[model samples]
Target: MDGVNAATTDPLARIAELPGVDEAVAEARTVVDRLLGHRVLRRRSADVSLESALRGAHASAVLDGAEAPLEQVRSGEADDPRVKGALRVSGELGQLVETWPKAPRQALARLHTLAAADGAGADRLGRPRSAAEQAEDPAGLGAPPAPIEVEVRLEALGALLERRSSAPAPVVSAVVHGELMALRPFGWGDGVVARAAERLVLIERGLDPKSLAAPELGHLQRREEYTAGLRAYLTGTPEGVRTWVLHCCAAIADGARDSLATCEALKRG
Candidate 1:
């Protein structure tokens, strides 16, 4: 895969051609489609969506180092600002879905603002970090790209989102997620925002329109692989990019399985 600043006419289309991406994407689609067909979703999809959102937020917060149990998150006892921010971003995702493809940079700023509401000052909320500012390294991936590099990559990403492409939704979603993870554009809450953005892409692109699958849960379940995948993406090699995309596809399938379990539990009751 080319760099984020690549001049290709369709970056995601190129990504779709990466080895194993198509197979992984097909598997993820099969899982998600099966999840969409689960009996409980017909009558109790609202319940499932709510549960999925809560679980997704909780998992994303855990990735941010909040680490509360799901029940704690559900009962409103998890008061970590990261937890609160992840919940806020989850709630805001539906509203941002439509905005994402049209104006990705603006949508990202909105997500960062929601995710960093408590952690960042008023002056810093939604603002990309300046060259002098340092981002917190939650993934232990080391220092982020310099500010100018961040700007260029983000601009390129924004353009990619706004343009029409023939790539599969999973491919596009993986790219969006990987690029944001690598960029860490903001000083705070970039991880939450990036995960939220991935969900939004999956929703907007129709991979998981109701947002039932909790990919964050899948990522959390495979925490070591999650970190390793992102680190591989940061390496900018074809093999590394392939590994990251396959990891995301597997996460989507795992998340769908988790949602299916939610439906099953609801059915048994």
Candidate 2:
């Protein structure tokens, strides 16, 4: 609701105001603005977006331990449940974008349902992990928060999602991404849902409303850096959290580069 540089009580604003964030935000916006200005994107936004979603699905899947060559993903040859789950969430994100600010909990539940229905059991889909259900996770999310803690965090997160934050879209998106991953608010497919949520913020906040960027592709290309950023955020240090925010901004810029490449490929083909 407020400008990126606006002062607000929202904790996310502090992370956004960090030293490197302004430059990262500027570069990411500049790159995406250039991509959006391209004649090809102007005329064929839908087609290019479809292709971007395909790559984004692949990248999201890769982050969730479902690595596959882009060609394989394009051909529907990558059939792991994790990849399928990631694709499901990616496809559904556009539908949820408009409603996310109004009803984050419902939107998040739908995301969980889409991502974890196949592997997390139908009964567990769209719900938080139960006390009895909390066990060693198969998805390698590491130690998960307790059910009580998850519930508390969800309430806070829900409140935070009610409207736009003073933070820049990229910064807000990164916090959404990091918080979900760290909280693992749902029992399964937290990573998939986290990423889906980040994309929603980008669109809803007007950072990339056409949703042409392949952000997950950026994460896929630099998984090590991405993981380090999340780890830094988890450290609870201002410097660490700021590093993560900056990393996300950089990733979005890289995603814009991929969007430009996609435009060129589509025009050539």
Off by over 4 Å in 2: 1-8, 134-141
lDDT of 2 by residue, 1-269 (tens): 55533555777777777788889899989998998888897679998888888888788877877767889888888877777888888788889887899999899999989988777888888988888875334334468778899889888988977855677899889988988888887766888888888988998889898888978888878888888888888887989889888888888888889989988988897
Alpha carbon lDDT at 37, candidate 1? 96
- What's the true lDDT of residue 261 in model 2? 90
Candidate number with greatest lDDT: 1
| C-alpha-based local distance difference test score of model 2 | 0.83
Can you give the lDDT of residue 198 in candidate 2? 90
Number of the top TM-score candidate: 1
- By summed lDDT, the worst window of 10 consecutive residues in model 2 runs over 133-142
